[model samples]
Target chain A: MIGRLNHVAIAVPDLAAATATYRDTLGAKVSAPQDEPDHGVTVVFVELPNTKIELLHPLGEGSPIAAFLERNPAGGIHHLCYEVADILAARDQLEAEGARVLGDGEPKIGAHGKPVLFLHPKDFLGSLIELEQV
Target chain B: MIGRLNHVAIAVPDLAAATATYRDTLGAKVSAPQDEPDHGVTVVFVELPNTKIELLHPLGEGSPIAAFLERNPAGGIHHLCYEVADILAARDQLEAEGARVLGDGEPKIGAHGKPVLFLHPKDFLGSLIELEQV
Candidate 1:
């Protein structure tokens, strides 16, 4: 069910600044920013050796990231993403184990153009987990 | 100057149960368990694509992980590990940027026998980050 770690998403107050911090200061190369209209957020990707770090900023006041930032003023980690061999099968297994998953019965296309589904934090010991099929 | 992500360590109360949960339910294969005598904790690894998930359990009453679990009984996501190409260079850069590092000026050999250092959560907007040189 679990494949590889897809990416680690961090909620940032400013995507550009965060991206710049990672690139200029940390020497990490930055990928072009992308706006996810569905999620009402803009994200910048910083590629690392085997994984990528996603810096997410809210595009609008109603954005989910905005609400998350509000609850966590320091803008901590948002979620952990794990690659899954089969999203539906993984979802079924998680559901059978009584884990609460976000979204309807379908997995949506995520920022990386992969099928992604989120599991509620309540189900995973307070960690918001995303399952991505790669 | 990061290498490849070594592993993402999650602080869990029950190492055996967590290991079982991941294996029996998620279909992730388990690796042999190892105890970090220096850290006063035991750990189990679950290897995935490109990375591994470490389940940490405190070994003694005064273990640091025990304190962490007390604060967050739900056992949420603990920290993110980034693989650095050069541990010293990366640590210097982070320190120059005013990030508070946990270890004293030197990276220690972690569970996987890689040089590792931890940055304070205060410096990373409430997210604890570990840098590992693989």
Candidate 2:
């Protein structure tokens, strides 16, 4: 089961522009951009009271966000992350219930240095759902 | 500018099936479906500890969710709603900062019976942002 709505990620073509929009214009407290080589994306977190808005940009040629940006030039809401108390339990429960997990059906270290897994968009009503243990 | 994440909406073709997926399979607490004629959509709220998940299905022919589902046969995350202390003030601030407010720039009564306004996707890194007075 999903716990808190962790963060909503927005895939953007330009990290600077997106960061400026949230910081300078929207007056949000944004974190410095951090590149996650494993995830192949650069991220900046725009902190909100109860949640966060993650601005993502492609870090390399094979970055998944690049493919997303290619299809959506303007970028868009890339994914929604929900915090779970026990990710492995959630994964096993979901798998038993016929939910497809992305990537090798194993948890990977995410941006927050926590275990995370992505659920297939097709299985989740076309919305890519990410589960983060926190 | 933005407060808590009010809800993440998912546009689904079949409300019943979608509701079942969350309730029966995911073991989530789902609300009874409600129709919002003005918005031309039917919605069910799935309550989470820190936030809520709003599942949306088209109510009429011109429903926006209908078009989204047409493009994506499997449902997907529709929009992100953020709670604001003062929506009108927030609207003016965003407008002054060059963010185009959708639908005549007026806050319309949303499903929660609260004033809500949608922002153009192009302005917010292609993510359709919704502000709701809380």
In the range B1-134, model 1's lDDT, one tens digit per residue, is 65566677788876777787778866788877788887777888888878888888888668767878998786767787878878898988888887788957788887668888988886665678788886
| Per-candidate interface DockQ score | 0.65, 0.72
Looking at model 2, how many pairs of residues clash? 1
Ten contiguous residues minimizing lDDT sum, candidate 1 chain B: B1-10
How good is the docking of model 2, as DockQ? 0.72
Clashes of 1: 6
Relative to the true structure, candidate 1 reaches a TM of 0.91
Provide the DockQ value for model 1: 0.65
**Interface RMSD score of candidate 2:** 1.4
**What tens digits encode model 2's per-residue C-alpha lDDT throughout A25-112?**
6677899999999889999999988888899999977987888899999988899888888999999999999999998999999988
Q: Which interface RMSD does candidate 1 score?
A: 1.8
